[model samples]
Target chain A: MKVRLIDLYVAFLKIGGLTFGGGYAMLPMLQREVIDKHGWATIEEVLDIYAICQCTPGIIAVNTATMIGYRKRGIVGAIVATLGEITPSVVIITILASVLTRVQDFAVIQRAFGGIRIAVCALIVQSVLTLSKKSITNTGTVLLFLASVALTLIAGLSPIAVVVLAIVAGLIIGKVKERRAA
Target chain B: MIYLELFWEFFKIGLFSIGGGLATLPFLYKLAETHPHWLTAAQIGDMVAISESTPGPIGINMATFAGYQAAGYPGGLIATLGEVAPSVIIIIIIARFLSNFDKNPKVENAFYALRPVVVGLITFAGLKLLQIVVYGEGVLNGRAMIAFAILVVGVLKFKKVHPLVWIGLGAVGGIFLNLGG
Candidate 1:
């Protein structure tokens, strides 16, 4: 039952190396590893980590990694997990930076990316639905979703505004529900 | 003046962009509009397209791309490192305190509130991208519509196909549609 630092590192490394399309895309991979593969935590624990990761002020992938690692081990686990998650991107970017200038306009690369863009769009949409299923279970949540969409698309409001508003609304709702239950 | 400013601007972006790389887009959009002026709005759009397609985190790809545009390799390194610093420091701190902090009710409620909002923000971003894909420059006309239809049906019906498959198929579809158009 004792988890080593290397176990934490390898777990996150596997998570980082396999995931594509970034933060949201990594969710399924994390679920597979943490919940399905390792049995380190349950699906709810993974979801809770994901939820906490979103609210905290850092990269979701790194944050989630730290949370999961800490859950499994301790503070050291957090360090290992964050490092494991980001190592691939950091190394790749370093290499790409070295030669970025010469191939900035490569055509086949552009075509491949052109296709990748569509896929990113789909992935983003899929993530939205997945999150919605979890968070928007009630009418108020649905209202928030619609209002957020309208504000973003029509009013062209900054996302920060929507986030702030949602936080305030959530606090009020949470307090009211608590009061009612009490 | 511009290159230094680009470095500083992206450094700030790197420092504060929480929740991952996609979270940095709003900041990048602001950067395009404000100081440095290294890239036009259109170029920022293109950068986003490229970042999404690449294998790395969106923020790192952007910082690297922007740095490369402004001052070559060194610039890319500085920007990438700068963006990463905040997360590194914060993760270390969170690691120190997270065990004691995890069960706090206020923290839990705050996350409960934030979850739907994150979904909303992500969904809004997707919609904006869809608009660009369907209506903006270089769109493959009806292909955007077709892709949307397929995505909706695929998710609703199968719901089990790995998203990477959808993305891979979409890429092929985009190429064919682009060629056809």
Candidate 2:
């Protein structure tokens, strides 16, 4: 059976509308929707998409939505899925902006956000651990992780510079491995 | 000149920020610090808080908020579209090429190499955020530290529990703790 663009749209809309804590937080939700719910892709395929989404230059949720959409229903699927993923945020922010101008300083709201800040920290830690287990499989990777942590936290280096350096390191490593095999 | 610059700046951000919204933070931090002078570091911190609590990608949330700051609604539209445009275009291109590209050995090697780098960046992001949350200007203090320790243990031990539950518990805990204080 051929998947329709509308199906892709609705699936992504659900993914975007409900999932919180950004891209990593959306993984389980996406797994449920795409793997168990829709059968659009296998778990392995989803993992691959996750890896690709991480490396590509864009929002991970959007990139994952686009990839899954394209996988399911081609170009039209991509467009609809992207629109679906973004629609919730756009609408919600607009509403929040209107309502928040008046009572943003209320003590209750401040307390709520203070709570959220702590939760955000937990989410970040969880994301790091999850990604580390999946991505850092070797000593080289461990060293890289340590170096990156040090650079950002201790050295006060720019993250962009670290990312660039990492990419260059990847290229060099790839060349070296290729030469060794050859 | 400002609108044009805004469009170009966001476009570049969309083009280069890999590994998702948090990945864009470094660039946005740089942008706020160096170029446009549209926002202060504290404002960026506030924007991050707003973005996290809100429904969208942090990058998009930031672009929209920053755009609104710079040129109101129209500017927000411009920034959002500009930030999203690159991914939309590149994904389309990659979609067309992905099948043939998937089997290429060099591409595979490149991706293999990239895995570690992505992890490193993500780890760095988490650490930086932790530093900010724990030790930034308004410190969380000893009470907050106890709460954070509990959260970490709860999450790591009970991996099956949903994150939203953790967030909810943290919120309730904060209310009670702050009330007591």
- List chain B TM-scores, each candidate: 0.65, 0.68
Model 2 residue B52 distance off true place after TM-score fit, in angstroms: 6.5
Mind giving the per-residue lDDT tens digits that candidate 2 earns over A1-182? 99877778788888877776577778888888889988999998888877667657778888888888877777788878888887777666555544544565777755654555566567666766776787788887777777766876578676667766776777687889878989
- For the predicted complex of model 2, DockQ is 0.43
Q: Which sections of candidate 1 miss by over 4 Å?
A: A1-15, A20-55, A64-81, A93-115, A179-182, B1-84, B87-100, B138-140, B179-181
**Highest-lDDT candidate:** 2
What lDDT score is found at residue A91 in candidate 2? 66
| TM-score, structure 1 vs. true | 0.69
C-alpha DockQ for predicted model 1: 0.38
Residue A46 displacement (Å), model 1: 8.5
lDDT of 1: 0.65
In the order shown, the candidates' DockQ scores are 0.38, 0.43
lDDT of 1 by residue, A1-182 (tens): 78878877887888776776567778888888788878888988777766656556656776778777766777677768776776666566556545644664776545544555555566666657766788888877787778877876678776666667766777788898899999
Error of 2 at B89 (Å): 1.6
lDDT (Cα atoms) of all candidates against the true structure? 0.65, 0.70
